[model samples]
Target: MRTDRTARTDRTAPVDRTVATAVAAAAAIACLGTLSACGPDNGGDQNAAPGKAASPAATSPAGGTGAGAPQPSAGAAKPSAAGSASAAGTRDIPAGAWIDPRSIPLDATYHWPAPAGAAKSVAGAPTFKLQELCHSKLSPDTADLGTGRAAAQSLAGAGGPDRWQAQQTLLYEGDPRPSSGVAQSAHAVFSDLREEVKACAKTAPGATVKVTGPENADYFAATVTVPQAGGNAVTLHEYLTAPDGTVNELAVWTTGKSGAQPRVPWVGPADADVAKAMDSALCTTLKDC
Candidate 1:
C-alpha cells in the first residue's frame, strides 16, 4: 500500500480544498490499484535468491566497466510471423521477447549503483503500469496492462530499500493488422497519458511531472516528483516503448533525503539515454530491426 503525501487533506477543510484534494487522492488510489496488480512485492530478503553472485566491483557506485557490467545484446533472435501468431489469428508477443539483462544500460549517468546481483526472471503477470499521471479516467479499460502475458526481470540493489530497478515486456493479443485492437489500445494509453500529465500539472500542487518523446515515436519517458512533508520527495522515472503488439517498460525509483530537492540533481537516467536504450532493445531483441 503506497501513500502519496501530497494527497493528504484535512477533513474539516473547505469544499474547494476537498475537491482539489480529491485529484491527488484519486491518482494515488489509481496508482495503488495498479501497483497491487503489477508492482513487485518489495518485502523479505531481496538478495536471498541463490544463483550466480554479482561481482561487487561491477556493481559498485564508483561506476566502472567490469565483468558484471550490463552488456549490449548481440544477435538476438527476431520474432517470426508464424511463431507470434496465435490461434485467434491475432499477433502474440512471444515469451522470449525480452531485452537481455546484460544489455540494459546502467552507468554513472543515473548516479546510482547497478544491480547487486544478476537479473532474476519474474513470473506471473506483466509488471508495468503507467500510474501517477491520473489516466484512470481517460480509459478504464486501458488503466492497467497486467492482464496480458509478460516477461520481466528485476535487479535488486545493494545497501538500502530505496534502490532497485525493473524492466518488463507485456504481450497483448489482437488482430495482426495495423488497425488492430492492440495497436489502438497502445495508442490510446499513450495519448491519454500525455493529456493527463497536462491536466495533473494544472490541478495538483507541489507535484512535478514531465513527459518527453519524439513526435510520432512509439516511446515516451516520464518523470514524476511528489513532494512530502519535511522537505523530502519521491521521484519515479519511467520509460515506455510500444512496438507492434509489445510494450516494454523500464522504471526506477529514488527518494530525496533531508532538504535535498530531487529535481536539482536527477537520480535516474536521462530521458534521451533511456529512450535510446528501449528503442535499441526493441530493434535488437524483440522485433525485426
Candidate 2:
C-alpha cells in the first residue's frame, strides 16, 4: 500500500537535487497532484470550436467523447482526497482556502444528472475560470491543475494570503463522436482559490464522484496531449462504459511547459501503481495504453 516511486520512463541520471526537488516535487505534485502536472490530458469539445486548443495539463476525455474508442487514454488517475463525507454528495471544493479538501483530485467520473443551467468558464493561471460547477464531476487531473495552479499564484493581485487559487477545466466526452475524429478528454476541475465558486456547492461526495448531465456539448471529444507529456493548467478526467447500458464521463483542463514557474503537481496520495506504471508505459510506447 505504499507505491509512489516513479519518474524513470528512461530519465537516465543527473536528476538529483534532493531527488530533483523530490522528483520535481513528485512531478510537481503529479502536476499539482491528482492526474496532472505537465501536459496532455484534455481539450476541445464543449460544443467545441470556439477556439479549440488545450492539450496541456488536466487534459481529459477527448474520447471517440468516443466512437472507435481506442484513442482516449492519456491521463486519468489522480484519486487523492481522503476527507470522507462517506461519498454520497460530499462537499468541500473551494480551493484558495490553503487546500486540504482531504487532498483533492478524486480523479473524475460520477456524472449522472447535474449541470442544468450555466457552466462555462475560461479564466486561468493568473485568475481562474472553471466557472460554477462546469458540469459537476471533474477530476481529469483537474486539467493540469488549472494552468499550473494559476502559475502558482502570488501575482500580487489575487487579493492576498498565500494566493494560489486553482480552478481549471475543459471536460467533454459523452461520446459525441470519435473514430479518431480527435477530442480525447475534457471535464476538468481544479480548486484552490475562490473569488466566488458560488459557495462551493456541497463540494465532494465521491462514489464515481457525483456528476450529472444535460450539460451541453454532444460527445466524443479530444484535441491532443499525452504523447510525450501534455501541459497547461492541467485538468483532464475521462471514463467510458458504452454497450447500450450507458455510463460515460469526461473532463479536461489545459496549460503547462511554456516557461516554468507555473508549478502545481504536488501529489502525495498514491496507488494504482504509478498509474499502472503510466499505463504500462503508455501501452508499451504507444502500442496503445
Candidate 3:
C-alpha cells in the first residue's frame, strides 16, 4: 500500500496549505485515470457559540437558512468527580472518551474506495473556534470558550479510481461544573458551524452548499460542491454532540470524473449510529448515559 506522510503541526492553528501539499499530491495521483482533479483539504476546526435554531435548506449557491442551530441539550449527562479523574490523577480527558474509528461506517465504492487498514492517529492539539468552515479564517473569540482536549485521525482510500479521504475528531470539554456550563459551551461550537455553513454558501461564487436537518435536531449535515476545470470536488461535513459534552466531527472528501458531478455518500454513519458509538466510548468514563 502506498502512503503519503507529511510533517505534523499544531491542529489548533489554521491548517497550513504548504504542509497539505503532500497529501494533495497523493490524492491527485490516486485519481489520475478516472478523475482529472483531486478533492479539497481534510483539516478542520470545531468551535462556536450558542445561537438560534437552523432551518432545513436545499442545494443552492445563494446560501441556506441556518439561523440558530441546535444548542447542547440541557438534559445531557454531566461529568462526576470520579469520572473526571483516573486512578493515577486528574486528567484533561478521561479514559475511553475518544470515539473508536472502526465503529464509523464507510462508503466504499469502485470510484471512491475506503482505506484498508485502520485509521492513523494525527497530532493532538488545543481546540479553537473557526469563522467559517469553507475558509481557514479564525474567529476573534477563538479563546472565549477556552481550550478543550482534542484528538484526530486520518484515513485515506486504499487504491481507487477516484481518490478519497476521511477525518474524525473528538473534542471533549470536561467542565465538572453543573450541566449548564458544559452544555452551553458545546452548543456554542455547534451554532458557529451552522452559521459558517450559511456564510460559505453565500460568499463562495462557484461553490454550492446544502445543509440538512431541522433547527432543533442535535445533528446537522452539510455538503459543499466546488467546480473544478475537469470535474467537481465535493465534501461532506457532519457534526453532532455526544451525551457527555464531546463534539464529534466527520469529514469526507471526494472528486467526480471529468465533466461530472461528485456522488459520494452523505456525511458518514447515521446520527443514531454515531450517538450510540459515542455513548459507549464516553459514558464509561464521563457520565452515566
Candidate 4:
C-alpha cells in the first residue's frame, strides 16, 4: 500500500536520498509488518480493534514501557555450551522457520499481540523518523507512513516485571534486492539510528537514545528513555537487521513505577546470547542464519 517517491539525496541541496529511500522503505515495512512503529492508518480499514486510540506520548493503550535495570539471570552461560546453539552459522540454515514465543526472554503465560487498533489510533502524528538516517528533516505530511502492503506482522507482549517484546521477520524470497544489498541497508539503518540517538540528547531534553551494538555483523541495537512527570518513565531496546533478504527484528519495552528511573546504563546482550536468541527465533522460519 505504501508508495515509493523520488526525493533528493543531498542534504545541503534538498535531502539525503540514500537514507531517505531506505528509511521510507523501512517505514512502509513497519506499517505493514509493524516491525518499527509507524505513522497513521491513512483511511484504509486496518482491521485494528477499536479502542481509545493511542497517542505518540510514550504511554500506549497497549501497555507502559518501563525504565529499570535488567533482571538477573541465574548464572553466567558457559561459552562452549552457548556456541553449540542452533542457527549459529550462515550456511545450511533453514528458511521460514517457526519462531517459538518462549525463546524470547519474557514470561510466556502473559504474552499478547499488538493492539488490533494500533494503526488507527496513531493518526497524523509524525513517527520517529530516523532523522539521523536521512540526515535531513522529513515532512511527516509529505511522507505517507501507512497505506503500504501488509506483511504478516507477528506481535506479542509477555507478562513479567516490566518486560515486553515485539518480533517480526520479513523475507524477500523473490524480490530483486540482493542479500548483500539487504545487509548493506541494515548497516545504514543502524548507523543512522546511532546518529539519531546522539542528536536526540540535544533536541529532546532529558530523553535519551543509546545505541548499543552490532553485537556482531547481524545485529545493531539501542536503548531509549523518555522521562515523564511524577518520576515514571518509558524505556525501549530494540535489535534489527535484514540478513540476506530476510529481516529479523526484536524490540523490548518496559515501564517503571512513578519516580522509578533507569538505574544503570544499557550495554546490550553478549555476542553469544544475541546469536543464540536470533538463531532460535529465525530457525523456525528461515533455513539460513
Indicate which candidate wins on TM-score: 3
Model 3 poorest ten-residue lDDT run: 59-68
Q: What TM-scores do the predictions have?
A: 0.48, 0.18, 0.51, 0.42
lDDT of 1 by residue, 95-214 (tens): 234444443444343333222123322332333333432322344665443333222333333423344344343333222242355455545544654555445545455667776556
Cα TM-score of candidate 2? 0.18
* lDDT at position 282, candidate 3: 52
If the candidates were sorted by their TM-score against the true structure, best first, what order would they fall in? 3, 1, 4, 2
- Each candidate's number of clashing pairs is 1, 111, 7, 33
Over 61-155, each residue of candidate 4 has an lDDT whose tens digit, in order, gives 11110000011112321111111223311111122232444444443433433322111111121123233222333234422211111112334
lDDT-based ranking, best first?
Answer: 1, 3, 4, 2
What's model 1's TM-score?
0.48
Any runs in candidate 4 off by more than 4 Å, and if so which?
1-98, 108-152, 158-179, 197-199, 214-217, 258-272, 279-289
Q: lDDT: which is higher, 2 or 4?
A: 4
Deviation from native of the Cα of residue 271 in model 4, angstroms: 5.7
lDDT of each: 0.42, 0.24, 0.42, 0.36
lDDT of 2 by residue, 1-289 (tens): 1332344622545555557777666776666644343235453344442222223111121110111011122233222122222132211111121112222233222111211111121123222232223223333553332321111111111212212232222222222233221223222221222211222233411112222212232222221122112422222232121111111222233344423332434232232222232223212322222
RMSD of each: 26.9, 27.3, 26.8, 23.4
